[model samples]
Target chain A: MSSTRKSQVQSSKVASEQIKTQKDIDMESDEDRNDENRNDNQQQSRPKLSIQRQDGDNTNATYSFLNEDHTLGNLLRNVIIKNNQVEFCAYSVPHPSEPIMNVRLQVAPSCGDTKKVLKHGLKRIAKMSDVLTEKFQNALDKYENRMSD
Target chain B: MYGMEQINTATGFANAKFGSSKGQGAKGFDEPEIRILELSKYVIKFELLNTDLSVANSLRRIIIAEVPTMAIDLVEVKENTSALHDEFIAHRLGLIPLQSFNVDQFNLSDQCACSSMCAQCSVQFKLHAVCSDRDQMEVNTRHIQPLSDAPIIPVQYVNDKGIEEDPILIMKLSKNQQLDMNLVARKGNGKIHAKWSPVATCQMRKEPIVEIDQDKINRDLDIEKRKEFVALCPREVFAFNDYRNAVEIENSDKCIQCIECLRFAQANNLERAVKIAEREDKFVFTVESTGVLTPEDIVSRALQILMRKLYELGTQMKKYGVNAD
Candidate 1:
């Protein structure tokens, strides 16, 4: 009975040591935790865009868009640049593995709010794409009908 | 507003529908136009005019990466004696393009209500091949059978004579070797895996603009120089007109902006004799499909996805109260 109790104590001690190692492993794998967060974030389908304004400067800000790439980034940047109030606008994908795009904007002093320009750009792109969809559908129908004939 | 001034050629700037000028806002931009140049079973060439480069690039990117399609995502191997391992066979199965015209009927697996998989989110397929009589049996995509009534099937190609071509080969099995497996096809986009991409290639290029000053070339350079200048162009963009005895633009559209002829002319003291530039508003696009979907269907579906993204962003912006206008 004494031998069995000693063995049991050793096994319990090993179990506690394993738990400590598991915690250590978890602490080491911050990327895994971030990946889980990202997956959960995607599952939740939350709004992926956020804005960060510069300290004491409303005209200068950075827009962080999750789950976006160069496709939307370049489009929005080009559209915003068309606005005279926008001094400069550029976008970059921070990491290839991370689906995130950061668009830095600096507008002229005359335009104090950077979000307004961003909203305008998004609206413009929406309208442009809407018209493109209609036109593309029409063109496709015409081509198909012609081919059938 | 970003378009540089272009010198009109003899035939004029044919592709540019709307030219942007200085100080123009986004509201001044006109609606983009699409003209289908060529359409075939596997390839499509179209011209997108009156649009920014960003729009054209976005469409290309979306067509290649964002369009949803059905592909084998998971496999359950019950038995296998073939030379290939289970994971190897599973990977090969995943790369096979499946008929995805009705992909909208299925929901994305992650968004589905079922615990892991169901009819609404996945299509079940069974593949069984056994080689007993033949010395060696060549397993092809035709071995895959849809377990359910789902419309998903391996893409089949047909020749011009209405004859079926050779189906895609999955593996080869020797005598007495067999493979039995169950495949689950899920709807996904290329962003997850390239195997789910509907298009084989989606590419865009700016329309080339070429301008030649015939008078300047004839007066400034002699016959030998003119001949040398014409020979400098690799694309045959310039040809010497024997009847007129002057150098002329032969096929301006064929110019790839190599700038050989332009450099030659500049060396001969004719700076503005030849100019080459790409139009910012006009883009030529070519989309090739993997036979899972038609080129037209892929293009239209890509446009729909892009528009959906834009709408989502716009609505989110409104929700964030960013609309000052």
Candidate 2:
């Protein structure tokens, strides 16, 4: 009886060891699956940004228009001036009811002509705003008409 | 007197006949001979020999008669446009979410006899755009053809906005531009295809048709049931035909024939009495191989079916004192 009891104890110890090892494997597999799922979710959720280079190089700085309330002056002041070009980026809003920030930068004939650059850049910016505003007004008129009907 | 000359340049002769001539003293007949020739400056010459000179002269007079000549001219025009413009318009109209667009190569060809490379009917353009938005956008394209009469091939454009499970946008060129492209084939052929313009096909509302069968219509004539069907209809095509005291399917012209109505009717036991007929004007609805029938034919057939069902329903409703609309 004692011998049989000893054998039973040994077998139980072996079975318990097996179960412990299997549980460890299962835990590792679960962690691996969780990691894969997280990676796939991140990849799917990330937004893809389209960038086009006007001059075929990063030298001609390009800015993305982010439809947000950020000021252009603040963005320019913060972003580093690289390769003699400054890029301004912004997002587009869903509706015209939202406020739009007008970012204007001066272009000087000579790099040293700061005053002329500022003047010319401001003028160009004004023209751009006028064109954009006209488009917005037309869109507003259409929306209002639809709402009335 | 007229001079006689041999015209050697003549390739063939017409209106010549051979016959035996008659001898004078012995009363013997002799064969008459004639030579036919063509001359320069719109003239034909004929010479007669032997006994029957009078017959040869008559043939010559008839042969020199004025002949008419005709001239004809043919002209053909060839046109081509760049496919990039289409992508640009789709992008601008929010049909293609800005982020989902990729700058993959695009190529298009039409049924022109020219090889796929010919300017008469081929276009290719490439674009690369990445979506930078949180909301998904849906784009549906309609009637992207060189001509308005040309067949419409469905194209899809989408942004990252993932708003709905099934999103679609419809696009078409303005009627005037489509007409001009069809008419002024030479000048307008290649110009319209090159660049994407903000034309009216973009940002237009999608009109869909819903057809209800007339056969299975419920005789109980519940006004609430009719209203429920109309409310469930995505296109609002259901209307009450007061004249027949029955539900009338309105705007059958807009039906894409998706068979949503059939499913609805089956579930509700709305009598299978209604026969839904698709509109002939749907973009992909093509004439059968027999040939294209006129609008009148399609309408008459639809009306015939509709009227028959209305009459049947009218007879049933008369027992209930309900008049057919």
Candidate 3:
């Protein structure tokens, strides 16, 4: 029983050492994190968000969706362009393996909120889809009624 | 307001009438209405509303004649023993449409900055045809090679077989009928010669407004009478659908507003059967291109030229204090 207690103490010491080494490695990686932002005092305060804008100004904006695919991007583009205030909108996937879609939207001068416009367009599309499904169900019911007759 | 007595009948296209009776006339007067109906690779159809007939006619003329094109203007024959004469061959060569684009890059020979002909406004072509065999030989436009590196210059025509089409029969040769020549191509507008015209045909017509009263005709007339009524109008403006048992407007735009249907209705003792009214302010245009530039390009370029002239005139008027606005 005494020997067992000794082995347990040694194992606990090794585990603590591993924890210390892991902390050191993490700190090293933190130091290596982007020399450009290294001097930034607000780095710790910054929120870690996935989406980022590679390029843009007031009238134009280019957004990057890292994990999102092209299908959603294309659909969003098609719907957003329906607003008519969107002068030009296009999307591109850097590489097939990257699985990232970059959407570039240019809002007209008279337009207000680009983000709100995009959300509204998406909502409108969803509503249209719901209406289509409802219509389809009604048509199916009518067909069945006729068949029964 | 041509006394629209039976509007909102829901009878057949009663609701189709646009509420433009008052607004269209007043609003269209200030800004000339130009609506492009159909646009494709090489064809475009549009309607110009509230414009004078003279303006439309002039636009049509400008599309056909004012558009610039490149053509072989001069040819030097070094050797030719072909059956066709040199002048005839040169004339034929001058007419071949060389598929040209980037029109702004080149200028007319006279309009060029150079004192004389230069590469900026003129392209040189050289052709050499020699037949040593006893068999017959054919020579077409393909043989005429552009000396410059310009890709659009010789206007290559490819056939379905994926082979370069007939070089174009410049002249047929029998054994020793060899032809060698140097040709010069220059930029020219169709105003000088129709060979440079970009448009094949540009036509405009007043827009036709078709009205149908199905309530009166369908309820009162028998099947045979209805069929007769459908067939009475020319241009096949209406068709009877067997499945729906309805007389529908197959192609309403073709209606010429001849009032023949109204006359037939009167003869058959029927009232308010069919009515067609031609909008005096609205017009429909049909444009087809000959080659090179597409119909859209031709129409847009014509409009651009027309607008430039207007802008220049306005500026000039401003100088003279004529109150051009």
Candidates' DockQ values?
0.23, 0.01, 0.01
Q: Give the winner by TM-score: 2 or 3.
A: 3
Clashing pairs in 3: B140-B167, B140-B168, B141-B167
Candidate 3 lDDT over residue span B162-223, tens digit each: 67665556667888768887877777777666677776777888878887887777777787
State in Å the error of residue B99, model 1: 0.8
Candidate 3 chain B weakest ten by summed lDDT: B10-19
Q: TM-score (chain B) for model 1?
A: 0.87
Q: Report the C-alpha lDDT of model 2 over B1-325, residue by residue, as the tens digit.
A: 0022122222111112111121322212222232322221112222223322222222222111110100000111121122224324432332221110111122222224555233333221222222234233222322222333322122233323733333334333322221001111111111122111111111111224344455446464376776666666566567766676567777765555566666767777664544565222112211111011121122123223223322442343344342212
Candidate 1, position B12, lDDT:
32
Docking class of 1: acceptable
Would candidate 2 be rated incorrect, acceptable, medium or high by CAPRI criteria? incorrect
User: Evaluated on chain B only, what are the TM-scores of all the candidate structures, in order?
Assistant: 0.87, 0.24, 0.77
Give lDDT: candidate 2, residue B167.
Answer: 30
In model 1, the fraction of reference contacts reproduced equals 0.44
Task: Report the poorest 10 consecutive residues by lDDT, candidate 1 chain B.
Answer: B10-19
> What DockQ results for candidate 3?
0.01
Tell me the tens digit of each residue's lDDT in model 1 across B1-325: 3354442342233223222353344555676799898898889999998887889999999999899999988777777888987778887898999999899999987678998679999899999899999999999999999999989999999886888999999999999988888888888888878888999889899988888887888998999898898898899988998988888888987889988987887888888988999887799999999988999999988888888887877777887777567
Taken over the whole model, the C-alpha lDDT of each candidate is 0.82, 0.30, 0.62
Model 1 misplacement above 4 A? A1-46, A54-57, A144-149, B1-27, B218-232, B239-247, B266-271
